[model samples]
Target: MTFGGLPTRWEPPGASRGVALVAPGRSYPPTAPLLDFTRVALLQHGFTVQQIWWDSLTRGEEEPEAWVRRHVAAAHAREDADRVLVVGKSLGTLAAPYAAERGLDAIWLTPLLTDPSVAEAVGANAGRQLLVGGLADALWDASVARELEEGGCQVLAVPDADHGMGTRGAVRTAEIHLEVARAVEAFLAGAAAGAGA
Candidate 1:
């Protein structure tokens, strides 16, 4: 499906618990390992997934936050789901404020903690939020993560993992992936229960 001329990949389960809108990083497409695993996890959890694709080169003159908000909001409106969840990575974390504004649950992978706006937005979310970041990532700030956790957001900080959440060894990297995936599942389970409540 396409929303506002932006390409999207939609997968709707037979009976959806809700909608999961995936926003990828500037260089990361939905097909990347982190996002692909997230898509599968959401599908397994009975969400209708909508993954948006975009080229940063073509973003034109709009501000990063404004562009992200416009496209994300457009896609959210197009989905028209009663319940919504947002999963964003890296640059896509720019949409944090929008998701927070709508009180939607969200999972942020490798969020841009270096950006004050992004960190602030993530901290402001009233709904359930899961934030995963690598300790080795230059953009990941431990202090900020601690503060966000204190504010009620769930956080998973992987040791020896870089910006791509990859460790020095393949085996360890795979283990990290599994760990992140399990965290996602647990977080989604909690979100599902909260929604049912």
Candidate 2:
């Protein structure tokens, strides 16, 4: 997706601890539940958030890595946030390297493990990052996920869930979402604390 549009900025009063930049997946709205939940979590942990604007490019069009890099890096630099946390999904996993180079932590949802560069960037990032993916996802790699875990990444591998972390039935989907929320909350909390430390 092309990084175009106005960012949704949220600054909680007295927020002094850190900041978060949310990068969303291709074709997904920036107001997705995942981003909403993360915004609240970050606010509760005293972090300001900027939900980056996104508009998907044509399928045959190349993913705009340079555009993403310029925007994310510029935003991060402008904020001068000490304890930065990046949250992304699917194609947004492209930001891993930018975050990594800045020594920042991140949470990657439905990461593009099919891309060696994405996997390597996520795996090599210094902090103990969090990854969420389902076995049914075409882009997911269980071996690579395991390897990432072994190398300090935390993975939440869901059974029978697809690329969007969705299953067949409504009940199962809700269950998976609940589990994801719990994991994300814990991960963000821990990372914020660690950054404070």
lDDT of 1 by residue, 1-197 (tens): 67566546656566887898899999988878888888888988889889978788888998998888887898898886788999998888899999988888999999998899988988888889999999999999989999999999999999789989998799999999888999999998888787679
In TM-score terms, candidate 2 sits at: 0.89
Candidate topping lDDT: 1
Relative to the true structure, how large is the alpha-carbon lDDT of every model?
0.88, 0.79
RMSD of each: 2.5, 3.1
What residue pairs clash in candidate 2, if any at all? none
lDDT of 2 by residue, 1-197 (tens): 23355448888778567788888888765677666776777777778887776565643355566666666777677787667888888877788888777667898888888888888888779866889989999999999999999998989999888987888898988788777888888987787667669
